[model samples]
Target: MKRFAGMLLVAVGVAGCVSNPGVVKTGPSTYMVSRQGKTGFAGIAGLRAKAMGDANTFCAQQGKQAQMTNTSQSSGMPILGNFPRADIEFTCVAMGAE
Candidate 1:
């Protein structure tokens, strides 16, 4: 029983050293805007809100805009977030209006 527990610990450690194995690429692509927001106001009794997706597109359709950011890969993977494309996220934020 002790030997089995030791083997389990070793396996868990090895798994941690392995890279993420579930990220999928949609082919040469960009970051699809996952969400959107807006703010405004009218009279004290008025209200403001944001609409998702392009109004020219549709209300039922989800909102999304693709901004090409991912540009490289390492170890046969697109190192997105803290790994490869961290800058892309920052750049994307800069593109948005404050």
Candidate 2:
């Protein structure tokens, strides 16, 4: 009883510690955004927003706009693995001069 509860708590804590989403620059104008577990499908809208925001920020640093070019999703193993993973690909395009 008590031992089982403790184990459950540990499992939940571990699950909560899953990796955070990240953006990886594939090229000067391309990037990939990805995340797992709660940061993925469990909170899909948040993930998308975060990914887009990251891409936008990166492009902004170089004076450009972030444009989403592709997206992907996958369901992982239950409990012991990431249940859902999300990925977004984006390109940075130069903003026209005002």
Candidate 3:
């Protein structure tokens, strides 16, 4: 049991080390992958919209989803220079979750 507790502590420490909202990455492309993992749910809808393949179509399709939120679009890429890449938010909170 002592060994197990030590291992659990180590795992929790590692998880805490990896779970920081400040650590984020970004990229640019016609497509958008979520950075909320890095950016937080602040970006989930935007990411979903990007993943939808057609921004307008995706918005139209998702407009009614209860979880969907209105997000603003920028004329230029938000993260990188329009290159397809991803962001990882190690600190993003898991919802209704443990």
Top candidate by TM-score: 2
lDDT for position 74 in model 3: 26
User: Candidate 1 lDDT, tens digit per residue, 23-86?
Assistant: 2333443222121111111121111111112221331233433234433222223221122211
Candidate 3, 1-98: lDDT as tens digits: 99989976765554444321322123221222232222222354454444333333332443421122233332334232232223321212224322
Give all candidates' CA lDDT scores. Answer: 0.27, 0.73, 0.33
Error of 2 at 73 (Å): 2.2
Among the numbered candidates, top lDDT falls to: 2
Pairs that collide, model 1: 53-63, 79-84
Q: Residues 1-98, candidate 2, lDDT per residue (tens digit)? A: 99999988877786778875577878876799876665323765666677678788888898898888998776555565555666889887879632
Give stretches of model 2 more than 4 Å off.
6-10, 37-41, 76-78, 96-98
- Itemize residue pairs with steric clashes in candidate 3: 28-82, 28-83, 35-39, 36-40, 37-89, 38-88, 38-89
TM-score of 1: 0.21
Question: What is every candidate's alpha-carbon RMSD to the true fold?
Answer: 17.4, 3.6, 15.7
What TM-score should be assigned to candidate 2? 0.67
Off by over 4 Å in 3: 20-98
Instruction: Please report how far candidate 1 places residue 36 from its true position, in Å.
Output: 32
